[model samples]
Target: MSTSKGSSSRTGSQIPAIGGLDLLKAEINSKHTDCLKLIATNTEGNPSVVRSYISELDNSSFILTWESANPSLNGQIVFDFKKPLSTKAEILNHISGLADSAITDLKSDTKNSVRLEASKQRYCRYRLFNVPGSAVTWFMFAFAYYAKTSTNPISPVSAVLSVASREFFAELFKYAFYFRIFEGIVVFFICLYISSAFPKEISESDVIKWAFSSVLTGIFSSGAIIKLARNLVVSKAKSKKIL
Candidate 1:
């Protein structure tokens, strides 16, 4: 009787789940505008003049059109997904690759131009990508403040060492940090040395005050300094006919 009961039981077929391709397509479609903005940034083109549209999409491939005010910067890029994208990283990498390729093409076209202004603009655009944004600059200022204030209250050497340590830490963050840190270290030490040169005993407050003032000065003047540095480099390049 038990064997007969087991044989009488029925099994139902399982339904298949929905394909991921549709969801991936939806995600890409939703982010079309953001992707276009990223492309403009990467290409150093004006986002206000950049136009983009997703022309086609299917399970395996998609087509996109990006146009800019400059005709040389307009193009259609196709992305072929060898497999269904299961993660956001896959989608981002594809978009980033497209942007990088477009920028590379633009650079290649302008690399041999003899115009100085055009060459300088291209060079500066490239440098801008490598430079840290304003947020990081402010972070460095905060680091300097903490380093200076937390050191031995009576030791001028401690203040100097604190600044050097701060710059060294900055170097570990990225090469872009190098420029700001170098400028900061120079300002900090020059001010400290000048304060020490006064014919009086340097108090702890004096060291802290000098360091704080120098950091503030550096922060306020950094933009102009960077601009001047860029101009000087460009001028040198022009003189050598390298630009």
Candidate 2:
């Protein structure tokens, strides 16, 4: 659209003023990919059109507007670093909630479906620090080490995999148990394979040394030892629950 301007009477000439407004709201559509929220916005370009999660907007007029017009912005530098104001109650509530989570997270594991939320699900499995799973992992680890012979002996790997996987699936699908078990199994097996399998054949005494050094490895690998110690100390104070 082009506008042609003509001269008017010099003394009584009036110039025309033209203006338009564009308001847009960004929303998430796909539950899988649209992870970012429209916390805020600024005057920007129209190149950020990767995925459209445009949900409902408050303005009824814009709600029915053409979808093609609400283009996304790209390479936009939006800085609202000026800390937003918070009330005293809000501040106190935030602090109290953080404290509650810190204390309860050590003792509990709640089911959370918020994928976009950055969370510490491992804290949910804080209760099952060790014990049955650890024992199974240790046995499976040793077995996998021994079974890596000329023959394909995956007995230990298979057995422990099934147990850990089953427990992991059965327990609200929280794979912390599986993660710990699998990590334990893999660490020892990797150690065993590296020392004995590679670089010719190793001496029996050397094998024993590597196996023993794993004492520290096991303690640090899955925090089983540390959690166990904490459990004992905290349990003595009161009947603590780690589930």
Candidate 3:
């Protein structure tokens, strides 16, 4: 779903939609934001913006994001256009309106309010779900590290706090691994869930036991399975600097 636009692009460009488990086209109507994308990116003297396709939340929605060394050039614009805007002026104005709307709605304590709010919107689920999961994994790692030391007995809390910073970071290092393997793992889990839910002679508990036990064989590894797709890594804005 790379950016494709214009009168020509829109003609060839279709309303690609997902219904049930199949990719299909929706009813042909005037509401097409794909046209807006073509007009802006192909237009001359355009402000460089990264268009990210995030269709999980909304089919018509995509995130218009920008990054600059100049702190003031940042904006977060999520547009799900109900009707097509024809001209370059219309598209640009629409983007401006959306950015202002996002900023106005966003409530933040930081001076860098827009960026902070934008990130919070995009990654709130990650913080809510992933951070706690990472904490548990790191606790296990901390336990392993403490177990090898025969000199003294250490509390679980002490071990976790000692490795607290590395706790989050260690999980981050596996981003590349997770991105590549996400799809396969997801399909595997769906199959497992189905198997557990409906069984003939075998019980649901047996299915669970067999599935997890095979994880040692790397066939059913339970790891990061979120983030269905990712942009290319090399020279990409998100990967340019690793902290």
Best by lDDT: 1
Candidate 3 minimal-lDDT segment of 10 residues: 21-30
TM-scores, all candidates, are 0.24, 0.18, 0.23
Rank the candidate models, highest TM-score first.
Answer: 1, 3, 2
Give the higher-TM-score candidate: 2 or 3.
Answer: 3
Candidate 3 residue-wise lDDT at 207: 42
Write candidate 1's Cα lDDT for 182-231 as tens digits. Answer: 65467456545643442112333445554554445455546544444455
* Reference-based lDDT, residue 85, model 2: 13
- The candidate, 1 or 3, that scores higher on TM-score is 1
Give me the displacement of residue 223 in model 3, in angstroms.
13
Segments of candidate 3 deviating more than 4 angstroms: 1-12, 16-18, 21-58, 61-129, 155-187, 191-243
TM-score of 3: 0.23
The pairs that clash in candidate 3 are 5-38
Question: Which candidate has the highest TM-score of all?
Answer: 1
lDDT of 2 at 86: 20
Give stretches of model 2 more than 4 Å off.
1-35, 40-73, 76-120, 123-243
Give the whole-model CA lDDT for all candidates, comma-separated: 0.45, 0.31, 0.34
